[model samples]
Target: MRTKVAIIGAGPSGLLLGQLLARAGIDNIVLERRTPDYVLSRIRAGVLEQGMVDLLDEAGVGARLHREGLVHEGFALSFGGAGHRIDLKRLSGGKVVTVYGQTEVTKDLMEARAAAGLTTIYEAESVTLIDWETSSPRVRWVKDGLAQELTCDFIAGCDGFHGVSRATVPSTAIRNFERVYPFGWLGILSETPPVDHELIYVNHPDGFALCSMRNPMLSRYYVQCRFDDKVDDWSDERFWDALKSRLHGEAAERLVTGPSIEKSIAPLRSFVAEPMRFGNLFLAGDAAHIVPPTGAKGLNLAASDVRYLSSALIEHYDTGSAAALDRYSEQALARVWKAERFSWWMTSILHRFPETGGFGQRIQQAELDYLVGSEAAMTALAENYVGLPY
Candidate 1:
């Protein structure tokens, strides 16, 4: 197989990049290791920033999102038994976020890709990305039982953290920065209604708790836990009890559990790969950087990377100049670092670390109290949460 551009992943990043490049008259192919159903059913990030929403709308992919997504002006931050609302619209001049899962975006993009006559290879195993240093990058894989090789002028590594593309790049060419937290997130998708009107980010003595919603019927909640926690160890009763205690009072009343759709523990970490490009290969999304889920910046950051990467690829193709490509690493890193900092800051401030005690804990509480009470602090939080000027 041959194409102008080869995207190795069918996730939102790869799919959206393919769509963007296609619209720019650049031919591309997308490959995925998971089936369509699995990809669409996987529940991930559910928040979309203003720029991301606008990008989807302008790309002609926001029809369903606009109809199904819940738009919110802001979210609530609860700490020290009080709720402080950061009005996103007031702070960011009408910028708002949407509560829609990343899976939904994948579904929309997948449907769009299919309707546009694009074929995505699923359940393909033994994939290997080769010859990235050459003029033509080759992607070899075994789909079902047959061996195949795909060659393209430019290759995009859109696969997430564990993908082969990241590994394929010589270690000498990459500088990886990572910070793994001592705790992970125990996220649950319950059939119950949301426990709060808006997303509630709660900081409790026990841990950090979040109350988010999938829609009117389903609620999403997450609690901080040890990284080694197992789902089997947490029963439905125990889960609800813990949640109720952490949420407290009126907030706990909203967590009426009917049935749980999904339950899993995700380790919290922040990662970034310096110089996201090397030779003929360019990495985007989770393949390049990963932000802790606290700030809800994962999907939005990925989408941002795709925007820059796709545009750079288009420029390279149109004029045969590597100027855009040459600066891709520097350009993408600026946003990546900002998002990384914001994510880290939120995590450190909101989540209680084991080292926090006595004066440290009191200091954290005071900071939280002041942040909620002060308009300036709220605006800072609102601007970062809604997005940081991009």
Candidate 2:
């Protein structure tokens, strides 16, 4: 098979990029190692920045999102046993965030691709990229016990952190920066109304907790946990109790408890592989960098990466110039580092680190106090929360 771009992975990044390129009259193919159902079944973050929402609109998948996604003008930061609202709209020049699950976003993209008759090969086995350093690059994979190969002008490595894309790059050529936290997020999805209309971030002496939702009826909640904690260690009742204990007054009183439909522990980490582009191969989303989820920057960062990449590719094809492509790495990395910093800063202030001791706890309280009390601090938080400009 021959194409202009051979994309690895069928996740949001890969699918979104394919859609953008196809609409631009570029030919591309997406390869996924798992079944479509499997891909959609994976639950993920629900918060969407305005930038990501705009990208969805550009991809022609924003109709449902705009209809169903919850819009929050502000979110509450709870500390000292009280909830304090940070007016995002007022602080960040009237910017806001949308609460839309990643699963729904992927579904919309997948449906759009199918409706447009775009090609996406699922259950592709042993997917590998070959000769990405040269002018002509090829992708090889196994399907239905048969081997196949594709030739393309460029390769997009949207296959995620454990996928073959990043691993394909020689370690000698890329510098890796990583900080693995000692804690993890123990989260659960329940079929119940959320405690608050807007998301609530709690910083309790015990730990950090976040009350988020997919919709009015489906709530997603998380609390900080030890790295070794397992799903079995947290029953539905126990999880509800822990979550409520961290909340204060009205938030705790308004909470609706229900059986958890999904439970898991996700480790917190900040990782970035410098130089997102390697020759003809480019990495977007999780393949290039990962941020702690405290600031809800993980998926937003991915969307920003895709924005830069798609713009660069579009310019390259339109003008027959590689100027944009040549600067893809530097351009993407600049925003990536800022998000990394924001996520790291939020995690540091909100989370209960085991080694932080008493001094660190006091510092966290002070930061939260200043953030909610000072307009400048609140504006900074709102700006980062609504997302930096693409």
Candidate 3:
């Protein structure tokens, strides 16, 4: 079989890319190694930058998001027993973030693809990208113990950090930069109202904690844990107490406790591979880079990569102009690096690092103090939070 594009990975990035290209009359096929249910079961961050929201709308899947997603004008940064609100809308010139889970975004895109009669192969095994360096590229995979091959104009490697796409590239051809944090986030989901309407990012001597939510009745919370910490070590009561201890004032008093429905530990890291475009095989989302969830930039970065890529491909097919395609790597990296800086900064100031010593702790406090006190700093925070221009 053949298509204009052979997209590996049916996660948000691949699905979103397929939707955008299909809408433009580009024939494509998506191959995912996991089942649809398995994909949706993966819980992820919910903060949606204005740009990603707009892109989802452009993909014809924002209806449910607008209907059920929470819109926040600002979020609070809690430090030194005080909570300070950064008015995102005002500080970012009337911009706001929508709190819709990544799972929901993927679901919406999945439904849109199904409704449009698009093809997505689930449980595709051993997916491989071949001949991406030439004018034609082919994707090969196994399904039902049968080997299948597809010829395509291009291949989109959206299969994520562990998938076969990026690994298929010759190591010497790609340059990598990575920083793994010393701690991981031990998180839980509970059927309880959130501690506050807006998200709260906490900074305490003990560690960092974040109060986030999936909906009105579902709260998602996380606390920093040592690299060796495991979920079995944290019970519901212990987790609740830890969370309460980190919060301040009303936030602490208003916190609700309940049994955890889900628990996991996610290690933090900042990774990027230079030159996102490897000939005709273009990388987007986790397949290309990863950002600590501090800035809530992971999914949004992938969507932004989609934005640049789709426009470039559309430009290529529409006017036979490879100019945008030629600039995809450089253009996408410019934005990717800026986001990396912001994510790294957020992680540095908001989390406890014993290695930073007491001096680093003092600096963190000072940074938070200055950020909340100065309009310039607050505006900068707000702008980055709401998202920079696409």
Model 3 stretches with alpha carbons more than 4 Å out: none
| The 10-residue segment with the lowest total lDDT in model 3 | 125-134
Prediction 1 TM-score vs. true: 0.97
lDDT of 1 by residue, 1-390 (tens): 889888989999999998888878899999888888888877898899988887787566899999999999988888877677788999887889999989889988888888988767888788888888889789888986999999999889999999978988888889999999999998889887788768988888889999899898889888888889999878777777777888756777656876677999999999999888878899999999999999899999998888888878889889988898888889888988999998998898788898767777788887887887788888888888888764
Query: In candidate 2, what are the lDDT values of residues 1-390, reduced to their tens digit?
Result: 999999999999999999999999989999999999999998999899999999999989999999999999999999899999999999999899999999999999999999999999999999889999999999999999999999999999998899999999999999999999999999999999999999999899889999999999999999999999888999988899999899999999999999899999999899999889999999999998999889899888889888988998999999999999999899999999999999999999888999989998998888998888899989999999999998
lDDT (tens digit, per residue) of candidate 3 on 1-390: 999988999999999999999999999999999999999999999999999999999999999999999999999999999999999999999999999999999999999999999999999998888899999899988999999999999999999999898898999999999999999999999999999999999999999999999999999999998988989999989999999999998999999999999999999999999889999999999999999999799999999999999999998999999999999999999999999999999999999986999899999999999999999999998999899998
In candidate 3, list every pair of residues with a backbone clash.
none
User: How high is the CA lDDT of each candidate model?
Assistant: 0.87, 0.94, 0.95
**Better model by lDDT, 1 or 3?**
3
Quote each prediction's TM-score. 0.97, 0.99, 0.99
Record all residue pairs in model 1 with backbone atoms less than 3 Å apart, i.e. clashing. Answer: none
Worst 10 residues of 2 by lDDT: 295-304
In angstroms, give how far residue 22 of model 2 lies from its true place. Answer: 0.5
Q: How many backbone clashes does candidate 2 have?
A: 0
